[model samples]
Target: MRISTFEYFTSGVSTMNNQQASLSNLYAEISSGKSLQTAADNPLGAAQAVALTAQAANLAQYSTNQSSALTSLQQEDSTLTSVTNVMQSIQSLVVNAGNGTLNDTDRSALATQLQGYRSTLMTLANTTDANGNYIFAGFQGGSKPFNDNASGVGATYAGGPGQRQVQISDTRTINVADPGSAIFQSVSSNESSPVSSGSAANTGSGTIGPVSVTNSNDPANSSTYTITFGTTTTGTPPTTSTVSSYSVTALDPATGTTTTVTPPTPYTAGDNITLGSQTVAISGTPASGDTFTVAPANTGNVSDTDIFTTLDSLVNALKQPADSTSSLATLQNALTTAGTKISNTYNNVLTTQTAVGGREQEVTATQTAMQTTSTQTASNLSDLVSVNLPAAISQYEMTQTSLQAAQQAFAQIQKMSLFNYLSS
Candidate 1:
């Protein structure tokens, strides 16, 4: 077959275009520093790079989350430490006030010191983080946890019972805070005793003197009992007898409510009425015609009182007149009970702090692992998609040489076309 001029020129043009395309691709790879510029250049590599990039981004986000969680945990740990210290100080004060040697004046002085500690503790409980959020407010960061009216009555916890947690890693979460209500204001019971007087007269039963009654033991235990006075039988010598039937009530520590029960008949003064595991004594002889009601001690509402208030109550009770023996004993028992509660609360705080620390450690481990994984993935992606610059350069040069040789051959063939050969 004889080659035509048109076909030869067309072939030469196509060869030149192929060389230009190859050169352009080589130049692009060099300029972009990538052997595979698009999916068309390296399909599998491009897909792999996309997945690797996503993994890297996720790792970055996890790193940020870890850092934030660490900061929050540190702040919480510091605040709880301060709170624990304050509680310890209060515990010491309570112990000192329990001593019988302390006179009213001495007790008053201790109470004053205790009040100062309570104020300090309140401030600590209501401490805020660097971001101005209450550390112990749980999820209610904007609200103050403890509110004191400054009336020496007690303080109240205004925050919720809910807690807040943070996700430190994929498989772990930790409680970042506990609410104020959990720390204070939940009490077992509240009891109020009112002093009253009265008179009964017919034609001539008409003389009276103030009746005095006092308590000397904790009414918290079933071993302790109370005596009540029934209507009086008038005579030269007052013939007033103790009421045989009467009820005594105390607060349930768990529910913070008063529980009442009737003692066996002939409830004598100084009889022991068992309440839970503790014992309370009722030992006040009431005048005839005077009714003395004996009831279990009430632990006020937890929201109405905190650890500080309980300590204060104990201090006040200790300061009562020695003749008010029951009141003194009740106060002593209250101190013991309140101490247990405060200790438990402090332990809980410690437990939470430990848990938070553990979570933070896990976050660190996960972050380290993720970082390693991301680095390896990124390197693998580079290997897959990135071109070897030297190799690409060599291949482009070979392709250029081939295209030039093809162009010269086409030119020689065109010159030998039949018409040009015959004219020569």
Candidate 2:
């Protein structure tokens, strides 16, 4: 092979340039501590690294979401516990109020204590989260759930239905808050009694507080019975009643409207008033225009009520006077009905507690899974992009040697080149 001067010089310069470029790339790798700086370096590895990196980012975000969900649920759980305790205290007050041995002075004191519990329960129902959202307000987190009733009787539910859930994991969502209506207001009464009493507005001096179910087969009996004070008028055919009988108006508790119900037969003083499953005797010469209500204690409307309204009603029933009728037996029935309502309320709170626990378990599991996935993804990413320090150093040294040799050979060849000879 005959090599011309021009060809030899050109080839030597090309060799030196390529060696320098290799050295520069090695330096870049060392500085960055990355095996490959761009996708061009290793297309398959780069693609894999990209997938792993994205997976890691998603896992980290899921972990964060799980943490937030757990925190909110825990806060809600603590709030519910406080509410249960408050209800329990209220229950104790109700049980104590039933003691017939306690007089007006003692019963009044118990009622005052019940009022305090109602205040505490309202505070709990209005619980808030770290972000200032009301926990029991469902989707209306920014709004308060319970407020004083317009009638000034008890706290009313102002929030939406149940809570809205957040995604704790890719597969599952969990409830973070339970509203007050489901937790407190769902309690219903077991039987019927007087919810309202006749005032002087009704001409009848006769009074009735609450009625009792003395017979069987009337568990679901919700018939409404009323007593009109005026005596029955006698006609040629004795249309209304031969005796001075009080008129009875029957109502349905489910409808909350007036309907025909069987009035206690005879309707005389101290007579056992029987209407469906309900029975109560009324006495005390009732004047014209007086009326009394006989219905169930649980009106099934807790959305606007605190469970303790029945307790307050019981207290009021106890204080009512005994005017030869509607005092002793009526008061006893009220106490029993109030106790039933409180019991139902307590059961609902317990059910809510169970639901909270279930949510906690779900969130905790999701957190663990996300954390594990993040850790594994991070390891894979490290392998794909991170440089092996010792291997890089060895390769860098070899590249440096190659570059130095190229420079030395090029320098020697320059003296013999046609360009140098031509210049000389």
Which numbered prediction scores highest in TM-score against the true structure? 2
lDDT of 1 by residue, 1-424 (tens): 9766787788788888988898999989878888777888778878888888787776677677777777777776677677778778877876776687777788778767877777777887888877898977877888997777577656766676787776644566656676766555432222222111111111111111211224434434422222333442233546555343434444445555765555434545666544344333444443443232222222343522356566566556555554444444444444554555555455555565666677667667777887787689778877876778899989888988998898788767766756776888
> Which residue ranges in model 1 land beyond 4 Å of their true spot?
1-8, 42-48, 150-152, 158-161, 165-174, 184-262, 265-300, 311-334, 393-424
Model 1: how far residue 139 lies from native, Å: 3.0
TM-score versus the correct structure, for each prediction: 0.66, 0.72
lDDT of 2 by residue, 130-197 (tens): 78999989889988887776666556677888677877666777788887777766643332233434
Candidate 2 lDDT score relative to the true structure = 0.70
lDDT, model 1: 0.59
